[model samples]
Target: MILKKIIEMKKVLVINSSARTLRSHSRKLTEVFVNHWKTTHNNSHITFRDLGTENVPHINENWIAAAFKPETERTGEEKEALKISDIYISELHQADIIVLGTPMYNWSIPSVLKAYIDQVVRVNQTWKLNPENLKNPYIGLLENKTLFVLLSRGAEGYGKGEYNEHMNFQSDYLKTVFNIMGVHNIHVVAIDGTSFDPEILKQTIQNSHQNVKSLIEKELA
Candidate 1:
């Protein structure tokens, strides 16, 4: 008798932070990634979060207090205050892979994306303070996850050792943040020089799309 092999469905979490819907190059990259990923992992479950259109609340005093408090000791009000944060953290925990697409705003990520980050980086949830080591006090909770960051910039030379590398705060900052959360397998694909001539910009975008496809194939293989 011949037996069929079973494949487990993977969970993917996709986050988009581009404010522009139609003209957003970052969004386009994410679309390409999702489409290609679906072709390979047809049974995978995908969860999408759009910070561009969604109102991601910034962390406030109440949120800070709630996150620091012990989970069992949290009051009704504190739980209410952390409702959004809990949801975001839950998604992060449930996802086997995470894909984030964002545009560079003032050499950093979009404010909405920043807000989402603030919501998820919770104390005793995503990370913990390690007093044993002062140099590295952070102990990340989430482990063995893959992350893909699709970035779009208006100008060029923001890559490593490039002319504008000194001014780049987007890619490195994101890597650091996710690394602190225990996601070590991170890949970044950037589409730069959006302000360039139309034909040049088109080619740049196509190159990024190819890069995304290649990355997906390598990762899935």
Candidate 2:
């Protein structure tokens, strides 16, 4: 038998998009951030999901049909699709904070995260349209939520105004999508130059760590 305990836990959801194991730099940054966050926010609970390893199926016709079907009339198959998506959305709802361990792949987020997003972003679930104001759209499910994105890249200087900045669709796209879901505050911490000099990569990681620490301090204040 499994023991069930009840306590006030500040749920934190961490998604790994690298499709690799803990060896990935993005994963490394996420782990460090979570560890420090846990220490700072003692007694808080955390749930970690490896999106890369979750084997979440790509969205298909059946999934779409189920997601759109009215709750009262949904069939067993439809319920199953909803159940899968509910698991993801439940975590988001429970979470007080979210951390996405993302790595730039071809200047975009990984397919796994995309698949997960498809599962979670359901109409009338995470958001809904306003009939009165057809021209005005609003989403409030995840309002006031905070998100931290830890990104890694093999190349260097992908920050703003860099030659490769325009190629960085990962952070910008994430911001837009999450914003649509009503997540207002988002932070991006990048560990670039991984494929370059070892010294530079080490320094970048250290600097990011400091930045995250300061952010946490500010948030707690």
Query: Candidate 1, residues 1-221: lDDT per residue as tens digits?
Result: 11111122768999999998899999999999999888877577899999999999998887888888788888888888899988999999999889999999999999999999999998888998999999999999988789999999999999989999999999999999998998999999999999888899889988999999999888755
Please give, for residues 1-221, the per-residue lDDT of candidate 2 as tens digits.
11111122456888887888857989988888887887777567788989888788787777789878788888888787777788888888888788999888888889999999898888877777777876658565776678998899889767889888878888888888888788988888888888889998899989988777777666665
How do the predictions measure up, each by TM-score? 0.95, 0.90
Evaluated against the true structure, the overall lDDT of model 2 is 0.81
- TM-score: which candidate is best? 1
C-alpha local distance difference test of each model: 0.90, 0.81
Which 10-residue window in model 1 sums to the lowest lDDT?
1-10
Clashing pairs in 2: none
